[model samples]
Target chain A: MREEPSQQIDRRAIRVWQLNGVVTTLVFAIITATLYIVKGQYNWPDFVSYITYGLAALTSIYLLVAIFVVPYIKWRRWRYQIYPHEIYVQRGLIIITRTVVPISRVQHVDTEQGPFLRAFKLSTVSVSTAATTHQIPALPVEEAEQLRDDIARLAGVDDDDE
Target chain B: MMNEMRHVHKLTIILYVFQGIKASAWSLIVLLFLGAGSDLNQLLNLPFTSFQLTLIILGVFLLVLIVFSWLRWYRMTYQLVNDSITIKHGVFIRHDRTIHKRRIHSINFTQSIFHQVFNLTEVQIETAGSDLEVDAVLKAIPYQEAVALKEKFLNLTNTHLVEEELPIDGEVEAVDEEQVEEEQPIIKEKKISIYHLLIAGATTGRVGAIFGIVFLLLSEIDNFLSEGDYERVVDWVSAQSIVAYFSLVFLYLLIVIIIGMIGYVNRYGRFSITRESEMLYIERGLIEKKSLSIPVSRIQAVLFKQNLFRMPFSLGAVSVELAGGEKDDKEAMQTVIFPLLRKKEWANFLKELLPEYQEDLSEMNHIPRKSFTFKALRMTIIYFVGLGVVHYFYSELVLVKLGVYLFALLGLYLLHRIPAFRRSGEQLVMQYFQVVMLSKEVAIVKKKDIQALETQGSRLARRLKLGYLNLSIMNNFLGRQFTLGFLSEEQLEEISEWYISGHHD
Candidate 1:
């Protein structure tokens, strides 16, 4: 039976993305504040002065959106599946993309997690082929392992070196 | 028995010199032209005789190439070990390469007109994973040695090598079958016709090469013939009428096209692709003979390419991609299965060669109106941006600028009407509309052969329920990626569902 890529990632990814977004917003705000302080010292150019104000407004809006909105949407959209003969991934914020990786061409499979993802018990499954690598990010650690093993078995790929 | 690494034929030195000059002439000419403004006069003004200086420079150039050639020749060596081929080469640093018999992509031999007279050929052995660093090349090997080497390579693999007969394994039943198969080894042969050559040459429009050369030479001449001393020469030439200059250009272009056509005909003259057992044998060239042996299993895909001019006539070239082979379209022709053919023949041709990929793609689903709207909005934004830039530069051409925008909007409308998709069992063909080239390019992929697929969306696109779909296949060096953007929600659902499942009979 035909269907869309059904499996979604661990919902903690939303919290992780929101936290990262907050950090980004903080960084942008700090830079803006520093620029305004510099502006306090001397008269900035007309264009530079205008840009500083615009950046200040944009970052504040970004901080609110990232902390409250974008993460939830990103989490809602992301999906992936490892079938008997293919791996499917559907993701994107503004443009939704659906991706498929056929098993026969798979060269290898890997499970990796960053320090942040590790704290949340999440892992990324990377499926490699002759062409490029596809990553299914933020799956539960056990699920990522299971998916990796399943893909390797289906693809019949031995752990040969690149 | 010990396997010994061997050097190629000594005559490779001559081949190297010929190749060195051919490769270096353009760069050397460019250097001369760039220097002609100041350096030539300064050299002429030197106390030494001009004749002596010229001879010294020529001597030095030849010495460099000769030394370089000697170093390369000395370093290059190949060894045919059990079930593998090892090559070692490099002037200062050593690159020792070992290619397994099973991994070999193709073994090709090239004999240029000069090598033809000398009865020497260059054998190039390429593997599935070759890249920039190492290319296995035997510069010049004698015909008999080359043939023997090819047989040895094939014998090691113990596959269906049709060109050479090997003793069957000790089974009487198998021997009888093998004997019967040996008598019917030749699969097919296709020769390019002169009529096909003319259509391809005229449609290709490669005569622009002359225009490129002439324009470069013209500017160089202008730079050197400035008002100080060459004023008389410039004036005498500047007296020509507009029509005369146009006629001269036309005449030159005509000559160039004729030359280009001749080159095309010579390169593809008597071209034929033959199959024997599991290997495809491509032999072509009028003045210089070249033959290639490629295993049918290694061919990743058959890719078709045609410009607008060729498309109307249903003529297109088809090349089979080999993993890790060169990607440039011009070099792609060297690996082309058929240089040109009518559209009607595509299905029949593919059915014969790759039966699984055969499909009827004459009709397809029309994209949702949202795709057109997305493109129109994007184009409008670009038009406005362009209008702003043009206005900033020359704001006075308001009517002309609007006219240009109007023309562009019409083109976008045309683009929206053309995209199509067709599926046949496990095979898929995407007729993607390329607005920049104003042509429709197609990608024919087997679902089981697909390597990866992806869907991406922007925040606005998600709100509008649209997305971009991209898929990759391992049939090429980088794995050919085919992508379609601004697909509607319904369309995205259809494609995403298609990818999530396997193609079953």
Candidate 2:
């Protein structure tokens, strides 16, 4: 926990994360609005309106946090480094997680690009073992591809069964 | 070697028909609820009565079902090639599956009442992969043929030299039981006696389930009785003397115990484990007898688990985690090697049955006492939230508050004792409590078997110099994860470094 991984994800990851946060906040806003509409259409009790108000307040607070606070913290904390025998990754906002995936146990490595990532020229590299998948999100597209290739080459076709 | 395709036993059609009926039981119930014997006949403009119409429809449905079952039985065939078994089945869309002898992880045989009546057996073959479904199923085969098949496959590539001519109907000549018996290099064998079965049943800890079922039945009975009758019954109960009430409670407990015993006996009455040929053969069940052969190489880890009742008696169950198999509703990805054993017997049991997993687990490193602060704080928050919910429902019960606090204290105490780990040679022995109450497990996993090692920490945990460790290991298709929280950051680093460097200190 004292030392961090050697590398950080693409700086543009902040924008991507902010976009994801915006979409989540929008979904919450829609849910709160629906609750309000339902409360108005039905002869709901007073507590129902209070619930709607509380939900709206919470959603707004989440929206502010998502836009201004989360993306930067997430971008700053996300780190990864590839060693000869293992891959180390550090991530998460509230609960920081450090993961070690042994290279010999790696089953496959893949690079993925969603619309937002593609627009930002970024790709997410996911390394899969037999049981779990670890992802380094929002890396420069070429760098992500190179990382995937490096991991796949280093993983090398071990004969042991998972 | 069976180079030609052969059909299963002729009883498969009958078995398939019964299976179809069982599968469509919901629709049959719905039809009965529709009640074609009633005034619905008047609503229909047909010449025949609704009852006769219903009968005619049912007869046609039965005919179709019989035809489908026959077709399914006719279409299904299997052939054993040099190193693989190829199965082709399905009535409409053909399914061809080839399972290599080397890849087969387990061969399990199940005998249902129907199979027993007809002297047939159902064979299931499992392979290592991501698929949750059994790789191949040979549904209704002669009991002797099933045994021979299991023996042959479990023997792996040894039978290539004995390429005996196949019989005319493709039925495997039952290998002489005595001849095959001599070939087994059995390392150890253990069988549960009737006395142990009774003890296991008594300590199954399923009294809660029996009580729940009884309560559900009583509540359902309320629907059939009039309110006045219900009140009279209640009044009669309330009017009983204290001795009678005590007797009633005693009777309820006796029933619970009896039911638990019966259930346990039925499931594990004839349980046995035999170790031979780099495989562990497990056979259990009194009526629906099931025999499973697990290749020792495929086992990912060994687990020793103790429930609350079993813990008091120093009894625990031993199970092994394997990668791919049909999702068994009862035990999921684990196969129990020992349903009940004394705590002291575990070392000897593993040494004899699975020498690869035998390791000294006497000296486990406990987490720092400071780690308990985070664990206790988390438990307190959860306790307060649970108390809030319970208080919302029943505010007048002071005993509820007292019980909740006491329960919370017990949980914190248990948490205080858990999250211990030790590395020995190439294996890590982890001991922890499950999310459920009073159940603890210790897993002995090889370093190579672990998929990933993860350490996580929150701000509070960081301040306290504590972290959580999660280890992933393949179990079924998706795998199972074990989490141990509230470890010192240095301990977390040491473990992670050991995993990465494959070095033990």
Candidate 3:
């Protein structure tokens, strides 16, 4: 018996990316404190804060690359099974929520890229229904376009004119 | 033709001026009060001369603007032809809005006491778009002409023209236009009456009066306590003695009954709903009589509401949710339909108004009995928890407050199981969806207007193989929330299938 793909979404991975959040906070705090010290407003107690900040900075650098960069690289290897009946998209570290959009209710599909995403040559695909909008962010530009076209074709909305 | 265009009453400008004056006076009073209460008098302070000058300038500007507005309003004209209604107005930027007859959803006529006295009516033409209201004051258009224009627009002859012209492949159009006309349905509609209006007034107007009285009593209680002398208060209380209280209560009840009567009389005074070949014609209202004609195809949803109070009287109101019109104000729903009907009459009335949904209604499954218990339990828990928290926090400030909370909890518990409910097949049907805390609504939503169907399952529900189904419809006035909870897995699947099939069909 073949287990449904829903099982994959229930699994968990250590979210090392959270350390990047801590590092980013530390970097911004250090920059602000350095500016304050240069202006002669820094206190010694506050100055000692940079020790924890330095530790966070070092750990975050490793965590960021391990979590974000590695995921982006490995995401290509990950496969999403899309069928006429259902679609399953899976990619996450800690918490995972697998969203299901029935094909019959799909109204329209859009592919867009931001500046950061453009630099990465990646795009986001958003599926819009009358009631709600769902998105799959940061796919390869070509793959995103293909997904959009496939979804549109499946939804019976002709994108040939566009 | 411009010269002959009927201007709104001259008093209309006077009414506007009065409104502006009232607004300005209230603002000045509030400012004075704030200035006196706070130490910010300097900010509001003005020398006598400056104050006089400011008032004079403001008054002059107000007067000039009022006169200009009146002139422009008086110059506004509207005309109804066979195909459309046209409104023309403007002082600086001339605006001529023409609404095709087919696009019109409803025509509303309003007559205030002043308008009634002047025998003038304000005609409001509602179309589908949000920003459009083609309104013009008809300076006494013969009631007959207004009725005739309404009838003309309600006739579906114009709608059929477009439908017939559309090309159909491999289909023989054997029927001549005359034969087709002959084959078109002629609906026999009932006329509203003084009695119906009385019933509407009794039910609707009495509720309004009760709320009004409660509001007045609450507002005046502070004044009665703080301002009145002891003797005066005693005198007032004495005036409300047992006999006096009973008499006053009786009189209030009588007044409510009268108002109900008046509401019915006003709304259904000359009510006549007729069908003229593929169109529904409704002529109603008293002082400012209105006539509306709606095409059969344009009907979006039909709703019928029955209240517990109205049940004994066998009075219900039916309203059609039509497409391509701005939603009426929330209060308008009360007087939107022919009011005060018996439950038995609903089936026949609905069949006459909407024959398409009759089969669907028969196939509807009743909400499971367990669902009501679950709903009741949920409501009870929410109410009790909320009550307990409030009492724990604000025990001192709340008045008769614990008793009130207990009473409210009791009321919710009772009403939760009032068997207020809904059922759906390939179509949507809901009964006693709450309108207010006290009132319930029953409506039939068409399948096409349903935008989406969502099935949600929580851990408990998933374990039990039960889920909640929500249907989102296009009508905003009806609100977007339609929850059917505690349905079995099979029921959920069936509901989804029904929703999908209905939409496609």
The number of the candidate with the highest lDDT is: 2
Residue by residue across B246-308, what tens digits does model 1's lDDT show? 998898778667777787778777788776666777887788788877777766656565667
Task: Report interface Cα RMSD per prediction.
Answer: 3.8, 2.4, 6.5
- In candidate 1 chain A, what residue range of length 10 has the lowest lDDT sum? A153-162
Comparing candidate 2 with candidate 3, which one achieves the higher lDDT? 2
Instruction: Return the TM-score for each candidate structure.
Output: 0.77, 0.89, 0.65
Output the lDDT of residue B168, model 3: 67
Clashes of each: 16, 0, 11
DockQ each = 0.40, 0.66, 0.12
- For residues A1-162, write the lDDT of model 1, one tens digit per residue: 134588989999987888788889889989988988898788876777787899999998998899888888888888887666567777766566666776766888899988778999999999889878888889899998988888888776422321
Candidate 2 per-residue lDDT, tens place, B380-483, comes to 88878987898899889778787878787777776778779998878999989887545788899998899998988887888778888999998777778888
Instruction: Return the DockQ of model 2.
Output: 0.66
Would you list the C-alpha lDDT of every candidate in the order shown?
A: 0.72, 0.83, 0.57
- Candidate 3, A95: how far from true, in Å? 16
Least well predicted 10-residue stretch by lDDT in candidate 1 chain B? B155-164
Those runs of model 3 whose alpha carbons end farther than 4 Å from true positions after fitting are A1-162, B1-62, B74-121, B132-156, B159-185, B205-210, B213-230, B236-269, B311-314, B327-329, B332-335, B359-364, B369-426, B435-437, B476-479, B502-505
